[model samples]
Target: ILNFKNLEYFNMDFCTAFSNSFLQMSELMASLKYLSLSNSYLNGTILDQGLCELVYLQEVNIDRNNLSGSLPWCLANLTYLRLLDVSFNQLTENISSSPLMNLTYIEELWLSNNHFQISISLEPFFNHSKLKFFDGDIYAEIETSHSSLTPKFQLTSISLFGHGDSGIFPKFLYHQHDLEYVDLSHLNLTREFPNWLLEKNKKLKRLSLVNISLFGPFPLPIHCHKNLRVLDVSNNKLQGHIPIEIGEVLPNLVVLNVATNAFNGSIPSSFGNTWPWGCFYLEYLVLSNNSLQGQLFSKEFNLTKLKRLNLDGNHFIGDIPKTLSNCSALQGLYISDNNISGNIPTRLGNLSFLDAIMMPNNRLEGPIPSAFCQLRHLEILDLSRNNISGSLPSCSSPFNIRRVHLSKNMLQGPLLGDLSYNRLNSNIPDWMNRLPQLRYLILANNGLEGEMPLQLCWLNKLQLVDLSHNNLSGQIPHCLYNISFNYREDNHDLFDQDPQILYQLPQLQILYTNYHNHKYLTNFTTKQRLYTYEVQPLHSMSGLDLSCNKLIGEIPLQIGELSRIHTLNLSHNNLTGESPVTFSHMKQVESLDLSYNNLNGKIPPRLIELNALAVFSVAFNNLSGKTPDRVAQFGTFEEDSYEGNPFLCGQPLLKSCNENGP
Candidate 1:
């Protein structure tokens, strides 16, 4: 309760803990230059006498809290005050004239997020230059919103909403060449940005038209704005290739995020420029969800200062360039869903400080180089759906790994000796014994063999384990089924393409227990031999691959024991019999491709309950008896997904009613 008699600035809006207890500082307001008791439980009337007492107050902010009463009506007593923010309160005050009209020096006034029933009109404060940051949808700027025809202030950044301020988009927003940061994010604006944004690009630094109904390939001309930096047009209806000459567009740009857009073509090679000399000098770049093609990262450029680069869901091709090792400051690198080929560059292991590397769904090959084991600080490493081969490297130190995905590769060998679908070809991976903190582990689609190690069950930190689609044939481990981790959408297709029915995955997704790899089932029961497909991965690990091998047997009920398997691909096996009921425990599966198998039985509705089913496929199997109609995604079978299954019925195929009854 100190009397801040000489206080210059005081804002108590977000501090919903105290109250007019600050009124004890009246002795301080006498000489105060700025005072704001917003939402600080400030209640009752705002008397003219109480406010007029502060003759020297310069700024006031009282927003977002319960404050009642009308606005004070009096002659301009505090002529020195410049700002007044009284928003989000219960004030039925009319802001037309009174003392408000006299304060010509008042630069910024914010009156929103409140229950002011009175229709507000901004005719009081006009021609205020510093009054740029206006936040209200009550007919703010005349250009963006179709609300007000006339504006009161020369605002550079106005976020005015409609009705209760469902803030409308400013049509002429781009014309304001002086605007630096314009954020109308998530205000439910339905209008598209005007086309003139590119033409009038002036000194604007950050331009964000995200979540707006914008279309067309962004045609931003680089020479338009010399000072422009951040250009975020994410979550829009945009399409087409990122101009290959993007570096030529906004040369001084730093952050260029066009994520979730429909953009296509290769990442502009010109973007590889470095600092002090070449390229866009970018620090952060996210071009995910575009249809981009060709080597996403090349030896052409060296983004030494690049920290985060996300290019997921693009069609980019070729090997990750070794020159990219020059990005000494790189922290997060995501290049998944591309056609990139060749062995993962060992040079990347030199990035001792690198944290995340997500490059799934590519054509990358070669063994995971042991060099990556040096990244003691690594957090997330996902290399799913690639042509990668080779065993996991010996992890040298305590890895800070939280998520490790090596699924859907040609990798072969045992995974800590545990087998989800088939048996391992080598001994239990030695490096796995050292990982005490491993949370997620996926080793599907390999030629791995051997008995699962019991020590792996002791990993209290282990969450997900996917060792499907290999020569791994044996009893599933128990610790995985009972142990828990936050498994959501990864367990649905836990063991797809195999010749068996999937009965359960109590907590996770066993999406496609009968993964149908019919083409490779010629030698199903006899050939314990492993397929010779070559593979490698981004992480130097003791990988396991038995994919495309015609291994067959009864759908082991013990398969349910691998509780944490992530990617289980037992497709193409001539395995038979109903899926074991115990498999309902694998709560953390990510990819399960059990297609082209000899499995036969009704699709287990219990398996249909897997909430984390990402890639589920039980095509070309003998699965029968009206497939479960409970899950929507489950009913989404294509002609190919259930083609060879004569007994299967329901939507996604043609559902047949009981022939004997209605």
Candidate 2:
């Protein structure tokens, strides 16, 4: 309160109610040395009459407020000021020429995200011998011509954060040998890789030069023993081979990302050969989108503490070294789009913490080892487009599997009847009915033969059921209408359940790669095109593909209760039915395909309500009717969508809606 005349520290941040009244008291706080009104939503100008008289104030933080108008030039009179943070405010107009330059003791200056006029020179502030941290847009070009005007301060950190024109790399950086953190990413600095910048900074920890115009090969330092933790130079024009001694030299590295570069040559064998088992501090190593070749070293990796390893988008050959199993903490392994051959090491199954293992588009062969059953936390297991054969491994339980991409291989065996693609060849497993999390059950293109098991209806959360291209028979289960996830209820007891229960589901992530510049992942066919879901939206994806099977019976009316289903394909099957009128309830349905089937009925008029329908095909069916009015998505359909039905007439077709031709 203003009553405290000697109060040296005043902080009103997030005090939404303390508005104009607080700004009025600024004139009384002449002795206040530190003041922070950040995010207080305070309005009004900080004019010459305000706290500008507090010339002895050491720090001021009024960031993220509604404050407007030019900060009074008299702020420069605060000769002892050490910190000034006015970022994210409406402070327009430039500060007086010497406002900040005159503060001989100002140490940290933050003027980012403000509307200040771009006519100020940063050169003046550099003269302060105590200034250490400066974050602001340098509008004027930093004059590198002044070799005599050396910076008086030793800056350990500098961040322009890609604001304003990126002037040439700060020349003064050469003199400040204590630099530890630097971020010049997404800037227009057209300089060659600055190898000399690391010469004196023995404690350099983090460095990011991403998306900059730095060119030429990265120079290998004479000695790389600094305690650097992160080095990201991704999306640059850098090239040449990574140094063979890099692993041994940068022993404290935690992240090494050089993706999307033109780097060539083999991954150095020294990476794993020199370090003793579990001696490295690295956790994430990404080298994707390069041309690195040669067999991954068999004895070079002792990565017991490693977590994420991405070597995809390369030409690496030979077996995935069995030594990879030595990384007991490995979670994500992406080796897709490579020439890696031979069996997946059974020892890899020992990594029970693995969450994703995507190795598609490779030359790997042999059956997936049963040892993988131990990876209870695995969510994505993709081995598609490989020479792999034999039935799928009988994982004792697929409790956490979300997406399994094993198509286009030499594999044989019955498709697992549930979301799991196990080696089960019997009636639909009873365990599948008990699974409350079952969503996608893709067993198409296999030797599965049996009745459509009624137990499947118990999967209240089922979304996608792809039993197509198989020998399935019997009637559709009517109980499918009772699916729990499809119905949103208002009676849910929010107070009775712990919110943490929702976190039990494994986190979804993309287990993918780009081959020939196209994303290659587990795909689902719908609307005449193959689709892949991104990780987040994948949670709401719903579809069914029971086409190309020998299924028999009437289409179940209960199917309409699945209001959340998006794509339903029952085409190319032996089903007879009056197009279920209940289908109109499938308001979210995007594609409906009932073609090449035995069905006779008037196309349900209510089906026209499916506004989200993007693809609809009912051709080759024994149906008779004036096709649903040419409206909404129906207007986009072509005659071929209804061609086989000689009795069906519509605008898309030349046939008229009459007794003889319609």
Candidate 3:
């Protein structure tokens, strides 16, 4: 809102609020020359009343907003106005016959993303000597029709986000040898990635052809750009191995992200060596979620400056590279959900500022190197579902840790030291309490113990806490009511008949309790008393799972308070509860797993309103009723996602229900 006395250029670009405040600039606007209000929330039709009052006005822009109405004659007076942009508005006007053609000095014209229908004859304004840049849906010839009429040397940039502008890929884009950047992202442009892109190979530095339906096993048959620095071809249906000679084609390709595609092939072995001796000094590598299967030959890339390397969700296996320590500047390493094995190298902790280590669901064993504490800046350490053994050390990480997933690991026993941050000098760092930054705590199936420390609740940043199947036995701390539990919940009595049972840590959105026994290989059959309880506002914990345990008594109707639940797993428990009408609150549940438990009741047909419910299972239960027609995925589920239920009836099961009435 700074006032200018001699403003040369005034552009209120994309500022909706400022556009509404322009009424106050009427006097100031009259004294000005160039004015631009591109993409503002300006309304009303163009009025020609005080038309040529501002004779000095040179350029005016009011593009992309709700402004609608006919062209005003006042626009013709500003003869000096060159760049006239009124694109993306609800403007209704003819292109050739409009008074805007009077601006003989007009340099650039833009009327794209608006409701302006292009008439066939739009070649009149094409002769404007200075009009080199124009954006509109009209495909009119934009050059003087002469034997050798040349376009001015002022054509460099263009933006086309969608249709109703420039009519699909411009058929006229052929022999313009000069270029720098071209962005055609998300336009439903149904054509092969224009072959001209690679062929046009002038001095273009950036090209984004993201999700333009450029289908193929390999879109580009040729890769011969020497200076292309950024190439993003993600989310397309492209398949096949990335041509190994890609480096030879584009020697300077630095950012190559072809993720989320359906490519099928082993990553080339001579990958890094093929790069023209650090030709594509790749700083970011993401080739995840494809059918790619191969040893992520990470040892190949010794690029000292590489920071992010993601090869996850593929079929990769093998020991993580020991030579990775050479990439000393690495900041993020993600190779999760792969078939990787072997112990992580001890030097991995040397990645001083490594923020995330996503290597879960792998066959890695051996205790996590205590030296991992050396990664003082690690925010996420996801080593879950690994065969890692031994107790965890009370982390003395200097930085605040956000996520820790040691779930399903063979790690056992109490933490190495006093485990309490209060005992910092004596081994445990008191900073742990001061560091209120534990977002996810999934230590399930680990042999961790020592009455759930009250100090843990100090992790005010807790979002997901899964301490299930552990030897933890203590009252659930009352202070953790604000922490969201994702996978499992700390049980009542913490598993003992202790009266000081920690009833609830209310912020839980996804609760998975070890319903019965603590020790592994033991069948839990507890005779706990059923008490009517009204859970507090536990609406945040959406997924509740109390399966794989033993607890005698019915489920509390208060369970209905979890309105946000998307997955409710109550199978394999000894609980006997009729389907309470209160279950209607679980509207968002996608997977309701109530099998293997001794629950008897008719299925709720109204439960079909849970439109998102994709997997419904009561197979091993004593329930009876005709399966609802909406039980689609449930019928498709293997007897496992729905096994154990005896009274349940569905197509996939042996028992068939007779009626839809519950």
Candidate 4:
């Protein structure tokens, strides 16, 4: 293609096989104005003298590659270049002395996620009057410079993420009046909220000053910036009541996240008010982890376009506003860790787009409304730590439901189940067979009784099963081996890796990308201690705990088929017979406990093959003869692992194998 003398544009983005030789040939195309090799796996130092020969080059993009070493100094020769993107690479160079200082005509520069250290002040680009878009990082401390050195350019979008202390705001931004997007997150700027930025930039649309240590009450902009859409001041020390007219001031906001701040007082009623043009355009509103008090909303509350409302970790009182149902487009409602009281409104079922309803650790009461069954898109429903009573509605089933946490409630009777820490008194219900997508079955700490049901075996995707501390009895269900305890590792499409469960709005895409890091969590007893597992660990974990139960009978040999299980606990039961020799096939078993049982006969010497075993115990069993050979993980076991097995002799135990005549 380089042979074509007049080739003005050449694009090979996403062409991973493209070689560095292409860069060497680019100098031949003297008329080339635009060249893009993004994500083309181009590595090594960029050819210093190759592309610089194309004096007519106006744009260059080499982003998302493995290109290392300092940027070519010859880039300064391309005076006509207007846009240059070398982001997401291994480029390491100081921004002050870099060739970018000579790109006086450059309008757009993208240098994010690189090892480029920036100077305390942005004096290098002061002469680049045409620069409008600059997105880079500050990897070193930025000293507060009192010198009144202003730049000639007014950037429309500037994003500078600081890794070290940026003692104050970038003084250059003070003179920028045409600013549209500004993100100076993680800077640790110890100054008060810079309200002057808003007062100056009338065209600003998105401003994210997250974790910058900005204190003092957030002063609202005096003038209504109609173009403003997103305002994220979260993870700061901003205190005092949030300006009540905030909604009226920024009516077109698509996202307003003020979470993890010291803000107090009630939410501005104007947030839910309709403007003369139409309903409020606000879609994602987050006010969690603040000292905010008072009722959630007033009588006129109606934000029709609101999608995700998070009012959790606050002192907010009063019932959840019934008018919340008016948000027909709502998807997630998080009001957990609050003082809110009253029954969940059945009207919430009207939100057809609702997917998550997390209201744990609140003063909610009354039975869960049966109308919730109407929500077909619902994925998460957490109402734990409430006074909700009565039998669970039989029709409580959403086709896409993935997590249900109704624990610590006054609920009774058979459950359609994941209801742990409740007062339910019944046999493991057969209705559970209908939940073919069940991944976690946590019915622990309840009055559940009866034999381990055969229907549980139908849940082929089961990963964790905790029936410990219950009245459950009868032989361990041999059919449980039919369930694939290891589901997540093999099924990539079962659950999305992205924890952001809510739908992404196009407008707030960049501003609200990291709004929440949601993770699936559950508590289970393992290694004689209760532990909470979440996210990646939870997905890779597979365990079964039937300890502290009335279960009696020979250990099911079929259970040895669960070779991928991480934990297996049948301790504190009346189990009999020799430990299964087939357990040697448990290649991934981390914790295995068969203690406090009537199991007899020689210990399975083949069990020594479990290299991943971390917590192993056959203590208090009536087993006799020498223990498994002390090697691999078995060598790490102490005397406690074989304490109560009086007839069992091993290296770890006080008794010798010779004394037991092994």
TM-score of each: 0.60, 0.80, 0.61, 0.91
Identify the candidate with maximal TM-score: 4
Candidate 4 residue spans exceeding 4 A from truth: 2-5, 144-147, 276-279, 425-437, 451-455, 458-460, 482-484, 489-521, 535-537, 550-552, 630-640, 643-646, 650-662
Error of 2 at 235 (Å): 1.5
Name the candidate, 2 or 4, with the larger TM-score value: 4
Better of 1 and 2 by lDDT: 2
> Lowest-lDDT window of 10 residues in candidate 4?
494-503
Q: Write the per-residue lDDT of candidate 1 for residues 1-662, one digit (tens) a residue.
A: 36565666666655755565555446656777777775476676666226667777877776655667777763277777777777777766445434666776677666665544322234454434356665543433222323444444555544443342334444335335555555454444545444355446465666655565567766656453556666777777787777666676667777777887788766777787543333456777877776777766667777777777777767777778888898887887877767778999999999876787878767888888889888877876767667777766766544577556565566665443122232236645655656775644544434565655666655655443445455545443544433343333233244332111211222221111112210011011111233322111211111112335455666667555565555455677666777666645655554456677788876666766555555566788888776656464455445665567877776667657486521
TM-score, prediction 2: 0.80
By TM-score: ranked, best first: 4, 2, 3, 1
What stretches of model 2 exceed 4 Å from their correct place? Answer: 1-81, 84-104, 110-124, 136-148, 163-167, 273-279, 414-430, 433-441, 451-465, 479-520, 531-542, 561-565, 585-588, 658-662
- Cα deviation at 118, candidate 4, in Å, is 1.7
lDDT of model 1, residue 510: 14
Which of candidates 1 and 2 is the stronger one according to TM-score?
2
Candidate 1 regions exceeding 4 Å error are 9-17, 24-28, 36-55, 61-80, 84-105, 108-129, 136-175, 186-201, 221-224, 273-279, 297-299, 414-437, 441-662
What's the lDDT of the predicted structure labeled candidate 3? 0.57
lDDT of 1 at 391: 67
Off by over 4 Å in 3: 1-6, 11-28, 34-155, 163-169, 217-224, 268-278, 298-300, 413-435, 443-450, 461-662
